[model samples]
Target: MMKTTKRSDRIDLRIDPKAKETIQAAALLRHKTISEFILENAMGAANEILAERRHFHLDAKQWEAFQAALDAPPRPLPRLERLMQEPGMFDGPEQEA
Candidate 1:
Protein backbone atom coordinates (compact mmCIF):
# COMPACT_ATOMS: atom_id res chain seq x y z
CA MET A 1 0.00 0.00 0.00
CA MET A 2 1.19 3.50 -0.81
CA LYS A 3 1.22 6.12 1.90
CA THR A 4 -0.53 9.38 1.11
CA THR A 5 0.90 12.69 2.17
CA LYS A 6 -1.08 15.84 2.82
CA ARG A 7 -0.63 18.41 0.07
CA SER A 8 -1.13 22.10 0.69
CA ASP A 9 0.84 23.68 -2.11
CA ARG A 10 -0.29 25.21 -5.38
CA ILE A 11 1.57 25.83 -8.61
CA ASP A 12 0.17 27.66 -11.62
CA LEU A 13 1.50 27.49 -15.14
CA ARG A 14 0.61 29.18 -18.41
CA ILE A 15 1.40 27.01 -21.43
CA ASP A 16 0.67 27.15 -25.13
CA PRO A 17 -2.45 25.40 -26.36
CA LYS A 18 -0.41 22.89 -28.36
CA ALA A 19 1.71 22.07 -25.32
CA LYS A 20 -1.39 21.66 -23.18
CA GLU A 21 -2.93 19.34 -25.75
CA THR A 22 0.25 17.27 -25.90
CA ILE A 23 0.37 16.99 -22.12
CA GLN A 24 -3.31 16.05 -21.96
CA ALA A 25 -2.82 13.33 -24.58
CA ALA A 26 0.18 11.92 -22.74
CA ALA A 27 -1.66 11.99 -19.41
CA LEU A 28 -4.63 10.18 -20.90
CA LEU A 29 -2.33 7.47 -22.31
CA ARG A 30 -0.77 7.00 -18.88
CA HIS A 31 -4.21 7.01 -17.18
CA LYS A 32 -3.15 9.91 -14.97
CA THR A 33 -4.69 13.30 -14.47
CA ILE A 34 -2.86 16.22 -16.13
CA SER A 35 -1.66 17.50 -12.76
CA GLU A 36 -0.46 14.03 -11.71
CA PHE A 37 1.44 13.48 -14.95
CA ILE A 38 3.04 16.89 -14.88
CA LEU A 39 4.02 16.62 -11.25
CA GLU A 40 5.42 13.10 -11.69
CA ASN A 41 7.54 14.02 -14.70
CA ALA A 42 8.58 17.33 -13.21
CA MET A 43 9.74 15.67 -9.99
CA GLY A 44 11.58 12.99 -11.95
CA ALA A 45 13.43 15.65 -13.93
CA ALA A 46 14.19 17.64 -10.80
CA ASN A 47 15.63 14.56 -9.08
CA GLU A 48 17.83 13.77 -12.08
CA ILE A 49 19.15 17.32 -12.25
CA LEU A 50 19.92 17.44 -8.56
CA ALA A 51 21.34 13.90 -8.31
CA GLU A 52 24.74 14.69 -9.84
CA ARG A 53 25.50 17.41 -7.31
CA ARG A 54 23.91 15.67 -4.33
CA HIS A 55 25.42 12.31 -3.34
CA PHE A 56 26.92 9.03 -4.52
CA HIS A 57 27.62 5.62 -2.98
CA LEU A 58 30.53 3.27 -3.55
CA ASP A 59 31.38 -0.23 -2.30
CA ALA A 60 34.56 -1.02 -0.30
CA LYS A 61 36.75 -2.02 -3.29
CA GLN A 62 35.45 0.88 -5.38
CA TRP A 63 36.11 3.30 -2.57
CA GLU A 64 39.67 2.03 -2.25
CA ALA A 65 40.24 2.40 -5.99
CA PHE A 66 38.73 5.88 -5.94
CA GLN A 67 40.99 6.94 -3.09
CA ALA A 68 44.03 5.50 -4.88
CA ALA A 69 43.17 7.44 -8.06
CA LEU A 70 42.70 10.64 -6.08
CA ASP A 71 46.02 10.15 -4.30
CA ALA A 72 47.92 9.46 -7.56
CA PRO A 73 49.90 12.40 -8.95
CA PRO A 74 48.62 14.04 -12.14
CA ARG A 75 50.52 13.15 -15.33
CA PRO A 76 52.27 15.97 -17.24
CA LEU A 77 50.81 16.93 -20.64
CA PRO A 78 53.47 18.54 -22.89
CA ARG A 79 50.93 19.37 -25.65
CA LEU A 80 48.62 21.11 -23.21
CA GLU A 81 51.60 23.05 -21.77
CA ARG A 82 52.56 24.20 -25.27
CA LEU A 83 48.99 25.16 -26.03
CA MET A 84 48.80 27.23 -22.89
CA GLN A 85 52.08 28.98 -23.76
CA GLU A 86 50.84 30.00 -27.22
CA PRO A 87 49.24 33.42 -27.42
CA GLY A 88 45.45 33.15 -27.78
CA MET A 89 43.54 34.86 -30.61
CA PHE A 90 42.34 37.48 -28.13
CA ASP A 91 46.03 38.23 -27.33
CA GLY A 92 46.41 40.18 -30.58
CA PRO A 93 49.40 42.40 -31.38
CA GLU A 94 49.35 45.71 -29.51
CA GLN A 95 47.76 48.51 -31.53
CA GLU A 96 50.16 51.24 -32.66
CA ALA A 97 49.43 54.64 -31.11
Candidate 2:
Protein backbone atom coordinates (compact mmCIF):
# COMPACT_ATOMS: atom_id res chain seq x y z
CA MET A 1 0.00 0.00 0.00
CA MET A 2 1.24 3.46 -0.86
CA LYS A 3 0.95 6.21 1.74
CA THR A 4 -0.10 9.68 0.60
CA THR A 5 1.12 12.86 2.22
CA LYS A 6 -0.54 16.25 2.11
CA ARG A 7 1.21 18.44 -0.45
CA SER A 8 1.51 21.88 1.08
CA ASP A 9 4.33 23.32 -0.96
CA ARG A 10 4.02 24.85 -4.41
CA ILE A 11 6.47 25.33 -7.27
CA ASP A 12 5.88 27.63 -10.23
CA LEU A 13 7.70 27.50 -13.54
CA ARG A 14 7.72 29.86 -16.48
CA ILE A 15 8.17 27.54 -19.49
CA ASP A 16 8.20 28.29 -23.19
CA PRO A 17 4.97 27.53 -25.02
CA LYS A 18 6.58 24.80 -27.11
CA ALA A 19 8.09 23.17 -24.01
CA LYS A 20 4.75 23.35 -22.24
CA GLU A 21 3.00 21.70 -25.19
CA THR A 22 5.57 18.91 -25.30
CA ILE A 23 5.25 18.34 -21.57
CA GLN A 24 1.46 18.30 -21.81
CA ALA A 25 1.52 15.69 -24.59
CA ALA A 26 3.91 13.47 -22.67
CA ALA A 27 1.81 13.81 -19.51
CA LEU A 28 -1.36 12.86 -21.41
CA LEU A 29 0.40 9.80 -22.88
CA ARG A 30 1.28 8.70 -19.35
CA HIS A 31 -2.30 9.36 -18.13
CA LYS A 32 -0.96 11.79 -15.53
CA THR A 33 -1.54 15.45 -14.86
CA ILE A 34 1.25 17.85 -15.92
CA SER A 35 2.16 18.34 -12.26
CA GLU A 36 2.33 14.60 -11.60
CA PHE A 37 4.41 13.87 -14.67
CA ILE A 38 6.82 16.72 -14.01
CA LEU A 39 7.20 15.88 -10.34
CA GLU A 40 7.74 12.16 -10.99
CA ASN A 41 10.35 12.72 -13.71
CA ALA A 42 12.07 15.51 -11.80
CA MET A 43 12.24 13.42 -8.64
CA GLY A 44 13.71 10.49 -10.59
CA ALA A 45 16.39 12.72 -12.11
CA ALA A 46 17.13 14.29 -8.73
CA ASN A 47 17.57 10.87 -7.14
CA GLU A 48 19.98 9.80 -9.92
CA ILE A 49 22.08 12.93 -9.44
CA LEU A 50 22.18 12.61 -5.65
CA ALA A 51 22.87 8.89 -5.81
CA GLU A 52 26.27 9.66 -7.39
CA ARG A 53 27.18 11.59 -4.26
CA ARG A 54 25.55 9.23 -1.74
CA HIS A 55 26.54 5.80 -3.06
CA PHE A 56 29.23 4.14 -5.12
CA HIS A 57 29.77 0.57 -6.42
CA LEU A 58 33.04 -1.11 -7.28
CA ASP A 59 33.86 -4.47 -8.84
CA ALA A 60 36.12 -6.92 -6.95
CA LYS A 61 39.34 -5.80 -8.68
CA GLN A 62 38.53 -2.10 -8.22
CA TRP A 63 37.60 -2.72 -4.60
CA GLU A 64 40.93 -4.44 -4.00
CA ALA A 65 42.82 -1.50 -5.58
CA PHE A 66 40.86 0.99 -3.48
CA GLN A 67 41.58 -0.93 -0.31
CA ALA A 68 45.30 -1.13 -1.15
CA ALA A 69 45.45 2.67 -1.67
CA LEU A 70 43.71 3.28 1.64
CA ASP A 71 46.13 0.91 3.41
CA ALA A 72 49.23 2.59 1.94
CA PRO A 73 51.44 4.60 4.28
CA PRO A 74 51.08 8.39 4.33
CA ARG A 75 53.36 10.27 1.90
CA PRO A 76 55.42 13.29 2.94
CA LEU A 77 54.28 16.67 1.53
CA PRO A 78 56.98 19.16 2.60
CA ARG A 79 55.51 22.13 0.71
CA LEU A 80 52.06 21.47 2.16
CA GLU A 81 53.51 21.09 5.64
CA ARG A 82 55.43 24.39 5.28
CA LEU A 83 52.29 26.13 3.99
CA MET A 84 50.32 24.91 6.96
CA GLN A 85 53.01 26.12 9.42
CA GLU A 86 52.96 29.65 7.98
CA PRO A 87 50.35 32.17 9.20
CA GLY A 88 47.52 32.67 6.73
CA MET A 89 46.23 36.09 5.65
CA PHE A 90 43.37 35.88 8.13
CA ASP A 91 45.76 34.79 10.92
CA GLY A 92 47.22 38.31 11.30
CA PRO A 93 45.89 40.65 14.02
CA GLU A 94 42.43 42.00 13.18
CA GLN A 95 42.44 45.57 11.90
CA GLU A 96 40.15 48.20 13.51
CA ALA A 97 36.95 49.00 11.65
Candidate 3:
Protein backbone atom coordinates (compact mmCIF):
# COMPACT_ATOMS: atom_id res chain seq x y z
CA MET A 1 0.00 0.00 0.00
CA MET A 2 1.13 3.51 -0.75
CA LYS A 3 1.79 5.85 2.15
CA THR A 4 -1.00 8.36 2.88
CA THR A 5 1.18 10.65 4.96
CA LYS A 6 2.49 14.01 3.85
CA ARG A 7 6.16 14.78 4.54
CA SER A 8 6.14 18.53 3.91
CA ASP A 9 5.23 21.25 6.38
CA ARG A 10 5.11 25.01 5.80
CA ILE A 11 7.29 27.61 7.55
CA ASP A 12 7.37 31.42 7.74
CA LEU A 13 10.67 33.30 7.93
CA ARG A 14 11.71 36.90 8.63
CA ILE A 15 15.07 38.07 7.26
CA ASP A 16 16.95 41.34 6.72
CA PRO A 17 16.26 42.93 3.32
CA LYS A 18 19.90 42.62 2.20
CA ALA A 19 20.02 38.92 3.18
CA LYS A 20 16.76 38.24 1.36
CA GLU A 21 18.05 40.03 -1.74
CA THR A 22 21.22 37.94 -1.77
CA ILE A 23 19.25 34.74 -1.34
CA GLN A 24 16.83 35.65 -4.14
CA ALA A 25 19.69 36.54 -6.53
CA ALA A 26 21.46 33.23 -5.83
CA ALA A 27 18.23 31.28 -6.29
CA LEU A 28 17.56 32.96 -9.63
CA LEU A 29 21.07 32.14 -10.83
CA ARG A 30 20.55 28.48 -9.88
CA HIS A 31 17.14 28.36 -11.72
CA LYS A 32 15.33 27.13 -8.63
CA THR A 33 12.32 28.39 -6.73
CA ILE A 34 13.43 30.44 -3.71
CA SER A 35 12.33 27.68 -1.31
CA GLU A 36 14.08 24.94 -3.28
CA PHE A 37 17.33 26.89 -3.44
CA ILE A 38 17.20 27.76 0.25
CA LEU A 39 16.46 24.17 1.30
CA GLU A 40 19.28 22.75 -0.88
CA ASN A 41 21.80 25.32 0.34
CA ALA A 42 20.78 24.84 3.98
CA MET A 43 21.01 21.06 3.70
CA GLY A 44 24.52 21.24 2.20
CA ALA A 45 25.67 23.59 4.96
CA ALA A 46 24.11 21.35 7.64
CA ASN A 47 25.79 18.20 6.26
CA GLU A 48 29.20 19.94 6.24
CA ILE A 49 28.77 21.22 9.78
CA LEU A 50 27.69 17.80 11.07
CA ALA A 51 30.56 16.03 9.26
CA GLU A 52 33.18 18.18 11.05
CA ARG A 53 31.79 17.34 14.51
CA ARG A 54 31.17 13.61 13.89
CA HIS A 55 33.67 10.95 15.00
CA PHE A 56 33.77 7.12 15.13
CA HIS A 57 35.96 4.93 17.33
CA LEU A 58 36.41 1.21 16.76
CA ASP A 59 38.63 -1.39 18.52
CA ALA A 60 41.78 -2.63 16.71
CA LYS A 61 40.32 -5.98 15.54
CA GLN A 62 37.03 -4.41 14.34
CA TRP A 63 38.96 -1.69 12.51
CA GLU A 64 41.12 -4.32 10.78
CA ALA A 65 38.02 -6.28 9.68
CA PHE A 66 36.41 -3.09 8.31
CA GLN A 67 39.57 -2.31 6.32
CA ALA A 68 39.76 -5.90 5.02
CA ALA A 69 36.15 -5.79 3.77
CA LEU A 70 36.84 -2.52 1.97
CA ASP A 71 39.88 -4.07 0.23
CA ALA A 72 38.07 -7.28 -0.85
CA PRO A 73 36.55 -7.74 -4.32
CA PRO A 74 32.76 -7.29 -4.50
CA ARG A 75 30.73 -10.50 -4.38
CA PRO A 76 27.35 -11.26 -5.99
CA LEU A 77 24.62 -12.56 -3.64
CA PRO A 78 23.08 -15.93 -4.54
CA ARG A 79 19.54 -14.78 -3.60
CA LEU A 80 19.57 -11.79 -5.99
CA GLU A 81 18.36 -13.77 -9.01
CA ARG A 82 15.36 -15.21 -7.18
CA LEU A 83 14.47 -11.82 -5.71
CA MET A 84 14.57 -10.13 -9.12
CA GLN A 85 12.20 -12.71 -10.59
CA GLU A 86 9.52 -12.16 -7.90
CA PRO A 87 6.44 -10.23 -9.07
CA GLY A 88 5.38 -6.71 -7.96
CA MET A 89 8.52 -6.12 -5.88
CA PHE A 90 9.54 -2.93 -7.67
CA ASP A 91 7.42 0.15 -8.32
CA GLY A 92 8.18 1.28 -11.88
CA PRO A 93 6.57 1.65 -15.28
CA GLU A 94 7.84 -1.83 -16.19
CA GLN A 95 6.20 -3.44 -13.15
CA GLU A 96 2.41 -3.66 -12.82
CA ALA A 97 0.90 -3.53 -9.34
Candidate 4:
Protein backbone atom coordinates (compact mmCIF):
# COMPACT_ATOMS: atom_id res chain seq x y z
CA MET A 1 0.00 0.00 0.00
CA MET A 2 1.17 3.50 -0.78
CA LYS A 3 1.41 5.97 2.06
CA THR A 4 0.42 9.61 1.68
CA THR A 5 2.43 12.15 3.59
CA LYS A 6 1.56 15.83 4.03
CA ARG A 7 4.04 18.67 4.09
CA SER A 8 2.37 20.93 6.64
CA ASP A 9 5.41 22.51 8.19
CA ARG A 10 7.18 25.75 7.48
CA ILE A 11 10.83 26.71 7.62
CA ASP A 12 11.59 30.43 7.46
CA LEU A 13 15.04 31.90 7.36
CA ARG A 14 16.66 35.23 6.64
CA ILE A 15 19.56 35.26 4.25
CA ASP A 16 21.94 38.01 3.30
CA PRO A 17 20.67 40.29 0.51
CA LYS A 18 23.38 39.09 -1.87
CA ALA A 19 22.76 35.46 -0.97
CA LYS A 20 19.05 35.73 -1.60
CA GLU A 21 19.69 37.39 -4.95
CA THR A 22 22.10 34.63 -5.93
CA ILE A 23 19.69 31.86 -5.04
CA GLN A 24 16.79 33.61 -6.77
CA ALA A 25 18.84 34.00 -9.95
CA ALA A 26 19.86 30.35 -9.85
CA ALA A 27 16.27 29.26 -9.35
CA LEU A 28 15.11 31.38 -12.28
CA LEU A 29 17.85 29.95 -14.46
CA ARG A 30 16.62 26.44 -13.57
CA HIS A 31 13.04 27.49 -14.45
CA LYS A 32 11.85 26.62 -10.95
CA THR A 33 10.20 28.60 -8.19
CA ILE A 34 12.46 29.48 -5.30
CA SER A 35 10.72 26.98 -3.04
CA GLU A 36 10.99 24.15 -5.56
CA PHE A 37 14.65 24.73 -6.24
CA ILE A 38 15.53 25.00 -2.57
CA LEU A 39 13.54 21.91 -1.64
CA GLU A 40 15.03 19.83 -4.47
CA ASN A 41 18.63 20.78 -3.75
CA ALA A 42 18.20 20.50 0.02
CA MET A 43 16.56 17.10 -0.27
CA GLY A 44 19.32 15.88 -2.56
CA ALA A 45 21.97 17.02 -0.09
CA ALA A 46 20.09 15.48 2.83
CA ASN A 47 19.73 12.13 1.09
CA GLU A 48 23.43 12.08 0.29
CA ILE A 49 24.25 12.67 3.96
CA LEU A 50 21.74 10.19 5.39
CA ALA A 51 22.04 7.40 2.82
CA GLU A 52 25.82 7.37 2.57
CA ARG A 53 26.16 4.18 4.62
CA ARG A 54 22.86 2.61 3.60
CA HIS A 55 24.05 1.69 0.10
CA PHE A 56 27.23 -0.04 -1.00
CA HIS A 57 28.33 -1.13 -4.47
CA LEU A 58 31.06 -3.75 -4.53
CA ASP A 59 32.51 -5.74 -7.41
CA ALA A 60 32.53 -9.56 -7.26
CA LYS A 61 36.16 -9.85 -6.13
CA GLN A 62 35.68 -7.35 -3.28
CA TRP A 63 32.45 -9.05 -2.30
CA GLU A 64 34.25 -12.38 -2.04
CA ALA A 65 36.89 -10.95 0.34
CA PHE A 66 34.23 -9.22 2.42
CA GLN A 67 32.31 -12.47 2.72
CA ALA A 68 35.47 -14.37 3.67
CA ALA A 69 36.26 -11.91 6.50
CA LEU A 70 32.75 -12.20 7.89
CA ASP A 71 32.89 -16.01 7.60
CA ALA A 72 36.18 -16.25 9.56
CA PRO A 73 35.97 -17.73 13.08
CA PRO A 74 36.36 -15.59 16.18
CA ARG A 75 39.93 -15.13 17.51
CA PRO A 76 40.97 -13.90 20.94
CA LEU A 77 43.32 -10.89 21.23
CA PRO A 78 46.08 -11.37 23.85
CA ARG A 79 46.35 -7.66 24.68
CA LEU A 80 42.61 -7.36 25.18
CA GLU A 81 42.61 -10.45 27.42
CA ARG A 82 45.47 -9.04 29.53
CA LEU A 83 43.71 -5.66 29.80
CA MET A 84 40.52 -7.31 30.97
CA GLN A 85 42.44 -9.28 33.58
CA GLU A 86 44.18 -6.18 34.99
CA PRO A 87 42.60 -4.35 37.95
CA GLY A 88 40.52 -1.25 37.18
CA MET A 89 39.06 1.50 39.38
CA PHE A 90 35.80 -0.45 39.58
CA ASP A 91 37.66 -3.43 41.04
CA GLY A 92 38.64 -1.55 44.24
CA PRO A 93 37.41 -2.89 47.59
CA GLU A 94 33.88 -1.69 48.30
CA GLN A 95 33.29 0.44 51.41
CA GLU A 96 30.20 0.05 53.60
CA ALA A 97 27.56 2.68 53.02
Name the best candidate (by TM-score): 2
lDDT of 2 by residue, 1-97 (tens): 9999999999999999999999999999999999999999999999999999999999999999999999999899999999998888879775799
lDDT of 4 by residue, 23-93 (tens): 99999999999888999999999999889879898899999999999999979899999999888987887
lDDT of 1 by residue, 1-97 (tens): 9999998999999999999999999999999999999999999999998997798889999999999999999999999999999989999986899
Order candidates by lDDT, high to low: 2, 1, 4, 3
How well does model 2 score by local distance difference test? 0.98
Residue range 1-97, candidate 3, lDDT tens digits: 8777664897789999999999999999999988989888889999988987896778999999999999999898769977877776455557556
Give per-model TM-scores: 0.58, 0.69, 0.46, 0.59
- The alpha-carbon deviation from the true structure for residue 94 of candidate 2, after best TM-score superposition, in angstroms, is 13
Question: What's the true lDDT of residue 63 in model 4?
Answer: 97
What TM-score does structure 3 among the candidates reach?
Answer: 0.46
Q: Give the TM-score comparing model 4 with the true structure, all chains together.
A: 0.59
Structure candidate 1, residue pairs in collision: none
Off by over 4 Å in 3: 1-7, 56-97
Q: For each candidate, C-alpha RMSD in Å? A: 8.8, 4.8, 14.8, 4.9
Q: Over 4 Å off in model 2, which ranges?
A: 1-12, 92-97
Greater-lDDT candidate between 1 and 4: 1
Best by lDDT: 2
Single out the weakest 10-residue window by summed lDDT for candidate 2.
Answer: 86-95
- Cα error, candidate 1, residue 9 (Å): 0.4
